[model samples]
Target chain A: MTLLQVAAFTSDFPDDMVEDEHDIIQFGGKGVSEAIGAILSGLGYSVGELDYQGERGWEFSAGAEGQQIWLLLSDLGDYLMLQVEDPSFMGLRPKYRQFREHFLSGLTDALNRDGRFHDLLWFAAVGDPFGFPDPAGEGGRRPAPQAWRWS
Target chain B: MASPPLQSRARVVTKSYRPMRGIEVVGPLARPEYESPSDIAAKARSAAAAYVDRHPEHRSKAMMAANIAGAGAGVVRGGYHMAKGLVDAAAFVQRAANPLPDVLLGRKTAGQQTIDLAGAIGDYVIEGRADPSRLGRDAKQAVANAKADLFPSATPVAANTADELARRFSIGMNQGELGANVASLAVGGPLAKAVGKAGEVMALQRFPAARYIAQGYSPEAAAYLAEPYSGMGSHWVPRRTKPPSWFVDSDYNVLKPRGITRGEMYELHARVDPKFSTARLPPRFADRSWRFEKSGLRRHGPLAQVWHGMPGATKAKGGGSLAAFGSGAHQLGEEGYQ
Candidate 1:
């Protein structure tokens, strides 16, 4: 089992703040998710409108080429279940899907622009397994997802 | 000529090349206008001093800030690179279109796992996460993601090791500088090790070179030796020593001593060794003297030599030697030697 954890603060926070904690927008809060979604769209990953199921979480899937990415967003943050045609290559991460999506999409964009033939072929998958669950499905925290920003 | 009076073992030592004739000249061949040690030192020092005098406090602060900013930029760049690598690796797996997904599902080898992980790490470095101490939970988690991206057993042993070490060394380094330094070292270290290992791998394949080079050598060496050198573009030699000096350092005596002043030494050092020149502060006065040892000054090539004169140099350039060096530095850069 592999575990990764991350703590982050929102970027470009407003300079003028005189109110409470809720007004400031903590890192893992709602504003962050919206920002993450926008960044994802900017990177070419289309996120379907999310639907909340009871108290469990929100579910949605983004698709590109032949792959479909299923994600879950809850109070904890976002979760991503990445799937390709290959059954063995399935990947799941908790509460960092926003970063993961952005990272993958940004990478694809960069590679395409870097000289498509060699660059695209060079980076097509996660180089190493980021996190995996144990037989009991109870392992350490999964790695926080990452995002790429060109500007 | 009377063979240049070479009578002292203490001064001149035997060497393969002919003695440097230009060293004995009173004035620099590059700068015919300036003619003495005092002249060169004064010119360089005054130029440097002017700038120093103007910004009594901001100079050092600016330098430190620039260095830190540079380091931070490196880290950001590295992080971005790693993120891009992850995408590539994921794409590679998808394109393989392999039917053995079930067969290889969780049994991936260390090599299989690390290739993409390396890329992800590259992104981390590029994105300005270079400083280990400054890494937030998000950065740590990003590093941990390598385990899932690469290893089937989900082991992040290698990635974690690399991340931890990089972080430790870069604790206080600027994010960019830290990232760049770590990235260079990381990339270079692996390349060096691989190159070392390749020589051995080629030798084991029973290649032709194995006959002599691999004699009594280990398996690794033999393998690398066996491979033909044709495909290997260029041999990369590890940097084992300081880079060669790109400037010439020569000293001259002051026929007439002048009043010691600030920035005079810096100007001289800048003239002669601009490539590696810097002014050193003295116990009595931070800026004084012609030699780097005395003034604690250094200059990059060409500039260092240019800054090697005295009184005339200081007086001609105006009151501030610091600004003189900074202002004409670009020109010195143009005529710099290797």
Candidate 2:
């Protein structure tokens, strides 16, 4: 599994919203991907086509502030985990708070309308020092992300 | 003839042996044979055990003696603190009542007197004579609540007299007592456990004789025996409720009159900036989060020097180094503006 190195926000949906793995892969995963794409596009970032890997997960590439960024939306049971990968955007340490504010604000605004996004059971911004270690020790000089749960 | 001769010879030999010049008779068998060190130690231990056994009340009597001594010491210390607190309180009231005499006497400046008064009040509060928890509650609201509870329909400000001060003080004291009682009851279980642990540590450190006795029994049994003496001192000390962050931020200063409400400020902020809205703010802002932010500034800014000088304020929450405060302030400012 890739270590999510940037600031990520996780929102767990109610059991009724996505009951099984199939539902998560089809409805929940697609919804999160589309919402993120729309948010990025609205913010003047050019979003690429959504790449779906069936039950595996889905992801998309986007260009924001003249930097290529990847949005990986994955399913973990009944929740959607959003991780941003910006190769040229530097480490998450310097821009943690900014990224958190921007991501939560955009996602909240996009989802919290007409009670359509009311299925959100919990929402939290994971702090810097994210992701698991590279088992092969190939990711050189990368700082291990610390787990932070900001409610 | 032979029997008669043998008897005569025995009598003659006995008489002659008494006059032998080179032979010496030993006295008391030469102090008996010297015993080994281990045998001597065993004998001593057995003697002690036997003596203790003979006087079954010895252990209880020793424990009682220790308890009495400890209790006496606790009482003395408690009384000292209580008296000191009373003196400080009296000094504070005197200065607060009339500041001109001290100023004219050139003993203390107005600022010095104010600092002293604050310190005295702090000592009083820390001594548990006053409720430190009540500092965070709106002052006006507290006074109103106290009035409603004690003297219904009587406003504290209506009478600007000594009697009014007395009445308000009485009400506050009652509230403080109630708060202390409630707090004690709430934390009774955990407090007892903590006290027990502390007592165990104290007993191990202070009593070598008890430890020797304890070696003869199981650890659990020994702990039970030493438990009573462990908490003797703590029993006399009052449980302290931590003062609120705002109180610490106020420079160990007395509570001030609140001028504005968070809601009103939120409304004002909304009106000033078109982009500003309550929806954009974190949910906690609706509650006491604004006060936390304000307090954070004092902890993380120029006001920190004053807080650091306070007795226990520096150890309290948000009372960190200047660099930490800078980081906290930056985070708070970012959230506040957002």
Error of 1 at A92 (Å): 77
Candidate 1 CAPRI grade? incorrect
Candidate 2 ranges with C-alpha deviation above 4 Å: A1-28, A53-56, A92-104, A119-151, B1-338
Listed models, DockQ each = 0.00, 0.01
- Residues A1-151 of candidate 2 have per-residue lDDT tens digits of 1233323233433322233421121423666677668777886668888865322245687664544556656543323445554443353444643553555445445654424443332212222111222111223222223333323
Per-residue lDDT of model 1, residues A31-64, tens digit only: 3234445555666777666433211123455555
Q: Which candidate is the best by TM-score?
A: 2
Off by over 4 Å in 1: A1-151, B1-167, B170-304, B307-329, B333-335
Best by DockQ: 2
Residue A69, model 1: lDDT of 54
Model 1, residue B143: displacement in angstroms? Answer: 12
